[model samples]
Target: MEEKKSNGLAIASLVLGILSIVIFIFLSFIGLSWIGLILGIVGIVLSVMAKKKNPTGMATAGLVLSIIGTVLCAMALIACIACVGALGQTAETTRDILTTIY
Candidate 1:
C-alpha cells in the first residue's frame, strides 16, 4: 500500500487566492485593494513553494488565481490613483475659476 501526504501549503495558497479575489471585488472601491494585493502575493509565494514540494493541481490553480487576483488589484489601485489625481486637478481648477469670478 502507498501512503499519501497532505499538502497544507497548497491548500492555504488556494484559499488565499480565492479570498484575495473576493476581497478585491467587494472592497476595492474603498482603497482596500492593497489588502487583496498583499494576499495575492503571499498566495503566489505559497503556491510556488507547494509546487516545489509536491507539484499538484491545487498548487497550479492557486498560482493562476493568485496571479489574476494580483493583476486585478494592481489595476484597481492604479485606477483609484488616477481618479484621485483627476479629482484634485478638477478641484484646483474650480477653485481658481471661483477666485477669478470673485
Candidate 2:
C-alpha cells in the first residue's frame, strides 16, 4: 500500500484559521469588520483544501472556526450597513426639522 504524505496545505489551513480568529478579534475591537470578512473567506478555502487532501481533526476544527468567522463577519457587515442607513435617515429627518423651523 502506498502511503500519502502530508503537505503544507494542512499547515496553511491551520495558520489561516488562527489568523481568521485573530482578525475577527481585531476587527471586533477596532471596528474594521471588512478585515474579518476577508480573513474568514481565506480560512474557509484553505480548510476545505486541507480536508480534501487529508482529513484530520485540525482541519475539521479549522473548518468550524472558518464558518464561525464568516458568520460573525457577515453579521458585523449587516450591522454596519444598518447603522449607516439609520444615520442617513436621522440626518434627513434633522434636515427637514431644521428647514421647517427656519
Candidate 3:
C-alpha cells in the first residue's frame, strides 16, 4: 500500500493568497482593504510554514501572490489614510472650489 500525504495548508495558503488579491482589487474601494491585507499576511505565514513542512510549487506561488497582495493592499491603505489626513489640511483656493463643485 502507498501512503498519501495531505497538502491542505498549501492549498489553503494558495486560496487565501488569490482571494487577497481579488478582494484588494475589488473591495478596497469600500473600506475592505484591511481584510485583504490581513488575508495576505495570513497566507504568507501559512505558505512559509507549508514550505518548511513540504515545499511545493503551489506554496511558492502562494507566497509570492500573498506578498504582491499585501503590498497592493498596504499601498491602498496608506493612500486612503493620507487622503483622509490631507482632508484636514489647508487646501488651495482653486482645488477647494473644484472639490466643492463636485
Candidate 4:
C-alpha cells in the first residue's frame, strides 16, 4: 500500500502567506513597516518550502503573495530609514524635542 504524507507544510505555508499579506497591508496603513518586513520574510520561507514539498496551486498562490508582501515591506522599510536619516540631519534641538515627546 502506498502511504500518503500529510500536507501540513503546504497548509501552514498558505496560512502564513495570507497572514503576511494582511500584516503588510495593516502595517502600511499604520506605518509599522518593520513588522511587515519580518512577516514578509517568514512568508517567503514558508511559501518556498510549500512549493518544494507539494507544488500545488495553493502553494503557488502563497509564493506570489509572499513575494508581493516582501516587496512592499522592503519599500516601507526603505522609506522609514530615509525618513529617520532626514530627521537625524535636522537641528539638534529637534532631536531633544523628540526625545522628550517619546
Which lDDT tens digits does candidate 3 get at residues 29-87?
Answer: 89798999999999999888888888889889889999998889988887432254445
- Candidate 2 per-residue C-alpha lDDT over 1-102 given as tens digits, one digit per residue, 9 for 90 to 100: 111332455566667666666777776767776777787788788778778877888778777887787777777666433344544567676677668755
lDDT of 1 by residue, 1-102 (tens): 111232788888898899889989999988899999999999999889888878899989998999889889988886432244544567677677668755
Q: lDDT values of the candidates?
A: 0.83, 0.69, 0.81, 0.66
The predicted structure with the larger lDDT, 2 or 4, is: 2
- Clash count, predicted structure 2: 0
Task: Look at candidate 2 and tell me the lDDT of residue 42.
Answer: 82
lDDT of 4 by residue, 1-102 (tens): 111121555556666666667777776777776676676677678767767766777767767777777787777667332255445556776677678766
TM-score-superior candidate, 3 or 4? 3
Give the Cα error of residue 75 in candidate 1, in Å: 1.0
Q: How much is 34 displaced in model 2, in angstroms? A: 1.1
For each candidate, what TM-score against the reference?
0.70, 0.62, 0.70, 0.62
RMSD of each: 7.8, 7.3, 6.9, 5.5
Once superposed on the true structure, which residue ranges of model 4 sit more than 4 Å away at CA?
1-6, 80-102
